[model samples]
Target: MNSQFWDEKFSLNPNLYGEGPNEFLKEQLSIFAKGKILFPGEGEGRNALYAASLGWDVTALDQSYIAQKHTLLKAEDSGLKLHYLVCDVSHFIPEPESFDLIALIYFHLPLSIRDNVHQTFEKSIRKGGTILIEGFGKKQLKYSSGGPKNEEMLYDIHEIKSSFPNIQWEYEFDGIIHLNEGKGHSGDGHVVRLRGKIK
Candidate 1:
């Protein structure tokens, strides 16, 4: 989706993806000491806000201005500060090795540029920095839950592993899991979960 596509979506729904961080992201981040973190496609700022509360210097990027506004408002209400940028993922270029961690939660992209985008993400994190991701698996098409219906946009364990060849995986999973991440995502779903560190 482009900026206008997401802007309209966020503008229409007050909490498109809920106000809480993804369950997987929350669980994984709890074990790490606070550090600079990046959240791409962070719609509505749920994860970014949560990270800021945990003392991480959080930077969130999204294509939607409406989403950015909602995130900033939530951050202010919670007395937490976050760095948010309104830009398309294709145009966003983070400083090399600038982040201790990067989170990609349900951030699906077109197959055409998926590899390039992941490459950018790989370069954005410092050596040995961690990456945590949870996204719809290709089998999600069989379910009526969230995520893109297009199979090409969905992920698989092998595809994810190949996309980040420089990462040494700690855990990689692909299976059905129940989700209750607010109204935006609720129900049993097929997903791929990956936790890895840069080599």
Candidate 2:
């Protein structure tokens, strides 16, 4: 989907996906202290603002002005400040050894662009930086929950291992999650969750 599609989708409802962070992300963060974080494709800024509340310096990047609008608005409402940027992920290069944490929650891209973006992510992360990602797994089709319908976009643990071979997998798995958010995603869904540290 392009910016127009996303812009229209976000414009249709101001709080389309509700105002909260992902459950799994919250649970995972419980074990570690927050730090400088980069959130790629951070739609509506839920995760970024949440991280900011936890004392993480968050930089959220996305191509949609609609997304940045909601993100900045929500940040202001929550009394949290987040650095929001409008940029395409495929070419948004970051300085190496920059961030202590990187998040890619529910962000998926076409195969042709994914590799380069992933490469940038791999190179930009500090040696000890952690990456947290959550996305629909192939089994999500059975649940019919919100996500891209394309099976190719869905990822598995083995695929992730192969894709980021240099990252040490601290945790990676697939399981069902109950999502009660107001729009787009609501119900039990199968998803892949991963945590890795630069090696």
Candidate with maximal lDDT: 1
- Residue range with the least summed lDDT across 10 consecutive positions in model 2: 157-166
What lDDT tens digits, residue by residue, belong to model 2 across residues 64-96?
899899889878887998899998787798999
Q: Give the per-residue lDDT of model 1 (tens digit) for 53-169.
A: 999999999988999999999899999999999887987888999999999999999999899999999998898799999999999998877999789999988988899878999
Instruction: Evaluate residue 19 in candidate 2 and report its C-alpha lDDT on the 0 to 100 scale.
Output: 77
Clashing pairs in 1: none
Query: Candidate 1's error at 38, in angstroms?
Result: 0.4
lDDT of 1 at 129: 97
